[model samples]
Target: MEKIDNIKNEINYYLNKEENVKEEWIEENHPIDIAEALSELDASEINDFTKLLETEDLADIFEESEKDLQIDILKCKSSEEIIEIFSHMAADDITDILGLLPIQKRKELLRHMKQDDALVVKNLLGYDRESAGGIMTTEYLLLSKNLTTTEALNKIKKIAPDTEIIDTIFVADSNKKLVGSVDLRDILSSDDEKKLEELMDDNIIKVSADVDQEIVAQQVAKYDLTVIPVINKSGILIGIITVDDIIDVIEAENTEDLYKMHGVDEEESSDTTLLQSIKSRMPWMFINLATAFLATFTVAMFEDVIAQVAALAAAMPIVAGMGGNAGTQTLSIVIRGIALGEIDFKDNWTLLFKEAMVGVINGAATGLVTGLILYLMYGNYYLGLIIFLAMILNLLVAGMFGFLIPLFLQSLGIDPALASAIFLTTVTDVFGFFVFLGLARGFIVYLI
Candidate 1:
C-alpha cells in the first residue's frame, strides 16, 4: 500500500505542474498503478496525465481501468489522440471504451481511427457486451497451415510484438478458416523442414461469436487454455479471447450474481451519486415492503388466537425467524451452484430431494431444542408438541422454496438471484407463522 502511494505521489507531482512533463508521467509506471492514480485524480488531472503519457502506456492504463474512467479518459483525448491511443489498444478494449461513449462521439472517434481498425471495432460493437465477440481481440497471429516449422517460427518472431498472446499460434486454411493450432514450443523444437500441418494439433476447441461470456470462461477452464480462438458461423477465424479477459468475465459475472442476490442492480457502482444510488435501490425496497405486508396479513389472520394465548405470540416469531434463516442458507448454496454452472433445471429433482432430506434432518435437530424450551416455559406437553411439529413442517417448506424459487425463475428466463430471496422470505415467513399458529389453535384447549 505504501509503495502504491509513492507511485501515485510521483505521478501527481508531474500532473500538478501545468507544463509538458519531460519526466515520465506514469508512462513507465505499472498499468495497475497508473489505473489506481487515475481513479483518484479529477478530470483535469486525468486530462493532464493523458496528455503527457505515451499512447502505448495510455492504452495499457485504459485496458486496466474501470468503465466510467475509460469514457472519461477517451473524452480527454482529441480525435487524433483517441485514434493513436485506441489503435494501440486491443480490439476488445476499443469496443469496451467505445461502448461507454456517447453515440456521436463514438462515431466520430471510430471515423478518425484507421479504416481496418475502425471496421474491426464497429463489427465488435454489434455483439452483446457479455458475448464472446465483445471480449475477444482481433490482434492475433493467423499463420498459414502450409508453412514449414522454420517459416512459422520466423513469422512468429516478426508478429510476436504486435499480438496479445503468442503461447499458441492458430493455423488457417486457404479460406481463412481456423483449421488447427500449434504451441510455440513445437515450432521451436521441430525440424526446420517439417510441415506445419504435420505439427499442428487439428482438434482445435473454439466457440462462435455469439456464445455467452460465461460459456467462454467455462471452455477456457475446461481446456486449461491461455487463449481460445473465436470463429464465425462459417468456421472462419475472427479473433481470440485470452484467459486474462476470461478472468475478467468470470469476476464480473460473479459480481453481477452477487448484486442480484441482494436485490441490488448489477450495474450500480460504488462511485454512483447519492440520487442514482437511491433510484436503483428504491424499487427493491418497495417490493420488500409489499412482501413484508403480505407476511403481516398472514400473522393478522391469527390475531384472535394470539390475543387468547400470548405465549404463542412470542414463540411464533422464533419459528418464523428460524425458517427464514434455514431458507436463506439453502438459497445461498443453490444460487452459488447455479452461478458456477453446477446446478441447473436438469438437476432440479435431485437437488430438491437432497435439500428436503437436509431440511428434515436439520429441522429435527433445531425443533427438538425449541420444543424442550417451550415445554419448560409453559409446562404444557401439547403446546410443546404443537410447536415442534410446526418447526419441522416450516423447515421442510423453507428447503423446498430454496431449491424451487431459483430453479423456477431460471426456467422462466429470469435471473434467479434477483427474486429468489424475496419469494423465499415471503413463503418461509407466512407459512412458518401459519403452521405454528394453526397447530396451536387446534390444540388450544390443552394449552390453556
Candidate 2:
C-alpha cells in the first residue's frame, strides 16, 4: 500500500510541472498505473492534467480505467478532444463508453467523429449489449483466399498496424464470405507460391453476430482459441472477438450469476446510494418475508405438541437450521453447474441418484450426532429417537430439492439462481419442523 501511495505521489508531483515532464512520465510508466493515480485527482485537476496527454496516450489510459473514471475523464474533455481520442481507440472500446452516456449525448458525439468510424460504432451499438457483435472489434486482418503466401504476408504487414490481433488471419472468398483461417506461423512456414486457399485451415470456428456472449465465451474456451471471427447472416465477415474481450465476458457473467444467486441486483455496487440499495433489495426481502410466514404457519400447527414437551420447543430450530444449511450447500453446487453448462434439464439418473445418496449419508451422520447430544441432554431415549428420524428425513429432502429445483426453473426459461434459494429454504424449513414435531406428538407417552 505504501509503495502504491509513493507511486501516486510521484505521478502527482510530475503532473504539477509546467513543462512537458508529464509526457516523459507517462511514457516511462504503464497506462493502467497512470489511470489509477489520476483517478484520485479532483475534477479541476483531472480536467487540466488530461489536457496535457496526447490522443493516443489518453486513449490507452481511458481503455484501462473503471467505467466511472472513464466517464469522468470524458466529461472533462471537449467534443473535439473526445473525437481525437475516439480516433485512436478500438471500435469496441469506443462503443462501450458511448453506451454509458445518455442517448442525446451519445448521438451528438457520434456526429463529430469521422463518418466511417461513426457508422462502425453505430452498427456495433445496434447489437444487444450482451451479444457477440457488441464485444467484437471491426479491426481484423482479412486476406483473400486467392492470395499467395507472399502476397498475404505483405498485405498483413500493411494492415496489422490498425488491426486488433494479427496472430490469426481470416480468409474470405471472392464475394467476401468467410471461408477459412490461417495462423501467422503457418503463413510464415508455407511456400511463398502456395495460395492461401491451399494453406488455410478450412475447419474454421466462428459465431454469428447475434449469438449470446456467454455462448461465445464457451466456444472460445472449448476450442482454446485466441481469436474467433464474427459473421453476418450471409456468412460475410464482420468482425473478430479477441481473447481479451472473451475474458471480460466471462468475468461479467460470473459476477451476474453470483449476484442473482444471493438475491442481490447485479447493478448494485459499493458506489450505490443508500436509497438505491434499499430499492434494489426490497422486493427480495418481501419475498423472503412471505416465505417466512409459511414456515411460521407450519410451526403453529405443532404448537400444542411443542408446548407439552418443553424440550421439543427448545430443539425445534436445530433441525430446521441444519436442513437449511445442507440445502444451501447443494443449491450452490447445482447453480454453478448450470452456469458452466455442465448440467442441464436432461434426465440424468446418475446425477440425481448420486445427490440422493449423498444427502442420505450426510443426513444419517448428522442425525446420529444430534441424537446422541439430545439423549445426553434430556435423559430420554424417545426424545432422541424423534429428532434422529426428523434430521435424516429433512436432510434427504434438502439434497433432492437442491438438485432438482434449479433444473426445473431452467427448463421453464427462468434463471435458477434468482429464485432457487427462496423455494429451497421454504421446503427445508417447513418439512423439517413438521417431521420433528409430528414424531414428538406420536411418541408422547415414551417421550414423557
Best by lDDT: 2
lDDT of 2 by residue, 156-192 (tens): 9999999999889999999999999989998999999
Best candidate, TM-score: 2
In model 2, what are the clashing residue pairs, if there are any? Answer: none
- The ten-residue window of minimal lDDT in model 2 covers 14-23
Query: Which residue runs of candidate 2 sit more than 4 Å off their true CA positions?
Result: 18-24
> Candidate 1: how large is its RMSD?
2.2
* Estimated TM-score for each candidate: 0.93, 0.95
- Residue 349 local lDDT, model 2: 59
Off by over 4 Å in 1: 16-29, 376-383
